[model samples]
Target: MSKKLNMSRRDFLRLTGMSSIAAGVYTIPGVGGVLAQDEREVTIFFWDGPPLIGIREKALAPFDDAYPGCKLNFTSVPGGPASGYNDKLFTSLAAGIPPDVFIIEIGLLPQFLADDLLLDLKPYVDADDYDLSQFPDLAIEAYTHEGGIYGMPDNVASIAIFYNADLFEEAGAMMPTAQWDDPEWTVDDFFSSCEKLTKRDGNRTTQYACDVTGWDKVWQTWVRIFGGQLVDDPFYPTECTLNEAGAVEGLQFYADLRWEHGFAPRPEAMAMGTTALLQTGQLAMFYSGSWAFPNFREVDFNVALGHYPAGPGGRANYVYYYPLVVPKTTEAPECAWNLLKFFNGPAMETIIREGGLQGTSFAEQEKWFVTDPLPPANKHVMLDAARHFVAPDPVLTNFGEITQIMQAQIDLLMIGEERDAKVVCDEIVRQVNPLIKEGQWRSG
Candidate 1:
C-alpha cells in the first residue's frame, strides 16, 4: 500500500479560496501537485460501497503505478442512509470537507445534478486524448444530463433471464434467442414452457417455472414487452406510465405468473431463498440481473442465459448502467479527470478482463451477443437484449420513492389484492404523477 497524505479541512478551504480574509497568501501546509506548484497533495473522497471495485487495493495498484507522485486518499463509507453513510457524507459536505471524488449511481444522477453538487466533465472529455467512443452508448446517455456529461462509465448491471438447461432439454424446448427482430420465444411461449417443466407434489408446487420479484428490472422489462415506456419520454423522465394500456398489461402479466397462471414461485416461497431453490432444481427459471450471475454460476446444475421473453411489442429489456462522477468539492479536478478517463479507457479493460466482470464498453458491446462461454444454446442473448432496452425514467430525482411505489403496486397485483389492471394502473398513476411533475426533468 502506498503512503497517503493527511488532508485537513482548514488546509483545503484555504487553498480553494473559501476564506477571503487571507488574500494572495499561497502558504498552506501540505498542499501539492498539478493544482499547486510546491509538493501539493491531493486527497480524494471515495465511496466505500460495493460498486466502487476500483478503489480496492489490487484494482488501484495500476493507476498508482501509472501516476507516480499523485496520492489518493479514501474514506470508507457504507452505501445507504439506512447504513448511516448518507448522514456522514451530508455532515462532511455541509462542513465543506467532502471527498474530492465520490461514486453516484447513474440512477441517482438526477438528484445530485439538481443539487448542483457534481462537476461537469464535458470539457475534460474534449481536452484529453481519451477515446469517448470507447465507452458504451447507454452508459454515456445515462450520465449525460441535458447537454453536459457528469461522469465516466463504470460497470453496468443488466438483466438476463437465467434458466436451467436440464429442465429445457427435458421439456424438449428450444433456448431463447438474442435476435430482437425475430425472438425465438414469446411471453406465452415462455410461461407455457415454464409451466410444462414445473413439478408438483400434491397441492404444493415442488418446482417453480419462474421466480418473479418486485425488482425494477422485471417491471421495466414487462413495460417494454407490452410497448409502454416506464415514463412518457425517454430523454426526460416522468410519471407512472405503468397506467398505460401496454404497461398495465405488462404488470398484469407479471402478477399473473403466480396468481392467474400458477407458473411462478408463490409469494410465500420466494423468501425461502431463490438461489437455493434454483440450485436445487426446484426453480426452473429466475429473472435477475448480471450482477447476480456469478452467484448462479457456482451451482452444480447447468445454467443457461436467455433474453427476456417477447410480448406483443416483440423483444425488450430493462437496461441498467452506472456512471462515475467527480464531485465539485474535489481539490484536484484535473487529476481526478485524468484518473476518470484512464479508467474508462483501455487501461480499465485489463481490469475488466482480469475481474471477469460483465461490462458495456463500446468494444465489448457488439461481441458479447456472440460469446459462447455461457450456456451453449443462448449465445447472443445479452448483446441482443441491449437493443430495444428501456432505460429507467431519467427525469425524476426520487428513484428510491418511485421504485418503492412500483414494488408496492406490483406486490399488490401479485398477491391478488388488486385484480383490476386498470384500477392498479390508475392508482400507480395517481401516486406517481405528482412526484414526477415536481422533479427537475432532464432534457433530451
Candidate 2:
C-alpha cells in the first residue's frame, strides 16, 4: 500500500475553503496502516437495515466456497454517511483497519477517489477480461473516474412512481402508465388523477393524491422534465441553471400540489410517514426509488410501479446506485478482488431478486427483476425509467455541500414557507454556482 496523506480539518478548510468536511480528519493520531499483511480474512461492510441485512448474509454465504481458505468478516451499519457508518469507516481508516470491501453511495465516490482510498479495478477487469457491458451505462459511469473502474454497483435504484392501485380504483382515477415514453403519462394527466384521488373532510385530508418527496434527485427530476436543469450541464456543471423559467415552473407546480391544489398532505400529516400512509390507503401516489420495495412489500394493499410523468423534456428522471469497492488499503487484494467479482456476479442476483432491488446489469435486470412475479407486477416500469434516465448532477467532489445549499433553499418551497419557486431557485443558483465552480477550483 502507498503512503496515505492525512489532511487536518483546518487543512481541509484552508485547502478547499468549500463546505467540505470529512467524517474524520485524516490527521487524527492512530496507527494509519499497520494491519497484518498475512491475514486471509477479507472484511466487507454495508450500510442498510432490516431484511436487507439478512438477505446480504444469505447471498454472501457462497463466498467461502467460491474462494476456499478465505475467511469473510462482514458488518453492516444501519444508515448512510450521516448515520455513524461514515464515522466508523473513517475511524477504521484512521486506525488502518478499514474493511477490505465496502459498498457506498455513488455521491461519496469523488471523496473516496480524492483521498486515494479506492483501488483502481481496471487492471483486474483487463486481466480477467471482465465484461463491463452487462451493467447499465450510469452504473459504470457513476464509479468510473478518469477511465479507471473504481467500483461495481450492486444495483441501480432508479427513481420511479410507486402508486397504490386500490386507492386509484376507489377514486376512479386513471392509473399511471408503466411505460416511460408513454405520451398519455403527462403531468397534466397525472394531476388530473391526483385531483380525483384526493379526498377531504373539512380541510383535513382523508386521502391524499400524491406527495412528491423533496429529495434532491426527486425534485430535480421535475426540473429536467419541465425542460429545465439545475446546472448548466449534468456531467460537468459550470454554473447553476435552476433559476431558468422551466425549472422555476416545474418546482412551483410540485409545490402547488400541497399548498395551492390541496392535493398532497401537509407536513404534519406527512410526518405520519408516506410508507404507512400508502400502506393504509391514505395516499394514492408517491415517488420513491426501487429500494422502497422491501419496506413497502409489507403493505397489504396493491402497490404498482409508475414512471415519472412525461413533460417538455420527456421523461427525465434521476437514478442513484450503491457501488461496491475494494479499498486500496486491503491486505488481501486477491481475495478482495474475488469477493468484489462475487458481489457483482451472484450477489448481485440475490440482492435484486430476493431483496427487491433493481439490478445494475440490464440483462440480469430483464431476466431476474422483470420476471419476478411480485406486487408491482409491472416490473418493467423501473427498467424503462432506467433506460430513459437523465444524467445526474455533475459528480463534483463538493456535491454534498452543493446539495446542502440546494435543500436549504428548496425546503422553503416544499414546506410552503415560500410560495414562489423562483425565489428558491434563484437563491440556489446564487449559493450553488460558486460551489460548482469550486469543483474546478479543487481539481486545479
Q: Write the per-residue lDDT of candidate 1 for residues 44-158, one digit (tens) a residue.
A: 4344456434444345546555666555564556554446656776687788767666655555778888888888888887776556665546667767766788887666555
Kindly list the per-residue Cα lDDT of model 2 for residues 1-444, writing each as its tens digit. Answer: 899999999987786744233323422322212233333678888876764667777888899888885767888887666788888888988888789898776767777887778899999999999888876677677677777989887667787788999888888888889876577989888889988999889967898899866778888888888889877765566888999999998999889988899898887777878877888888888888777777665668788988878887777777776788888977677788888788778877787777777767777788866777767657788787777655755777788788888898988998899999998898888888888877642331
Candidate 1 lDDT (Cα, whole model)?
0.67
Q: At residue 190, give the lDDT of candidate 1.
A: 81
Best of the candidates, TM-score: 2
Tell me the TM-score of each prediction against the true structure: 0.83, 0.85
10 residues in a row with least lDDT, candidate 2? 26-35
Q: Report lDDT (Cα) of residue 5, candidate 2.
A: 96
Q: What is the C-alpha lDDT of each candidate?
A: 0.67, 0.79
Off by over 4 Å in 1: 1-55, 78-82, 350-356, 364-380, 383-388, 441-444
